[model samples]
Target: MGHDKSGINNELFFGEKNAFSKKYEAILYNESKALSPSAKVYFNQINAFLAMKKGKADLAYTHMQRIRVLYSWYPEIKENNYNEYLRSNRNLCIVLMHQKRFEEATEVIDQLQKP
Candidate 1:
């Protein structure tokens, strides 16, 4: 599904909390790889967001890791452009903080300071 039809904004803003969010996230994850990489990144981001909304910090971290790995790979070259996943890192910090992992959260936050 395209961004216009992804329903991400609607679900985040209007949809009530319930079991269906997991089903929706699962559907996105199950989509064929023919979906562009960037779109997959967005879908994983949505997964992390929904997981956090449901207080599933561990699952959200997993989603963030997936996005991070994808962003670290270069399409035409081999390089780890880690900053490309800074949003995911921020989300990771949030998730860690929610889990009461203060030290780990600080470590994740420190990544933002890298120049």
Candidate 2:
């Protein structure tokens, strides 16, 4: 499934708070990856989500950076799934701020402002 069809939204909207512990969302995302390698792109979001939820902003930023590399390697993915990329950038900015990287976060904010 593509990003739109992924279960991420379902989990976020309907899953219990306790059910989210122990990297549960990431594990479910991994199972989807096993069924469809194409879903790997979404894993970037999942990893970042788990990292940020655990208060590990550095790790979350790393995951966002990794997704940047992936997008660079596959521009079509970036173009086709721009919403996911935007969400990743938003997460990147948040994590950067959490890490006290104000300038970098501002740069990301600037980039987001461009068409």
lDDT, each prediction: 0.67, 0.70
**Which digits, one per residue and each the tens of the lDDT, describe model 1 over residues 60-96?**
8888877767666633211343444665677878887
List candidate 2 stretches off by more than 4 Å: 1-38, 112-115
Instruction: Provide the global lDDT of candidate 1 against the true structure.
Output: 0.67
Q: Write the per-residue lDDT of candidate 2 for residues 7-109, one digit (tens) a residue.
A: 4654444334455554565564453543432355567677787777666788778778877777778778778877877877887888888899999989988
Worst 10 residues of 2 by lDDT: 29-38
In model 1, residue pairs whose N, Cα or C atoms come closer than 3 Å (at least 3 residues apart or on different chains), thus clashing, are none
Off by over 4 Å in 1: 1-27, 31-34, 75-84
Local error of candidate 1 at 17, Å? 8.5
TM-score of each: 0.62, 0.65
Best by TM-score: 2
Worst 10 residues of 1 by lDDT: 74-83
Root-mean-square deviation (CA) per prediction? 7.4, 8.0
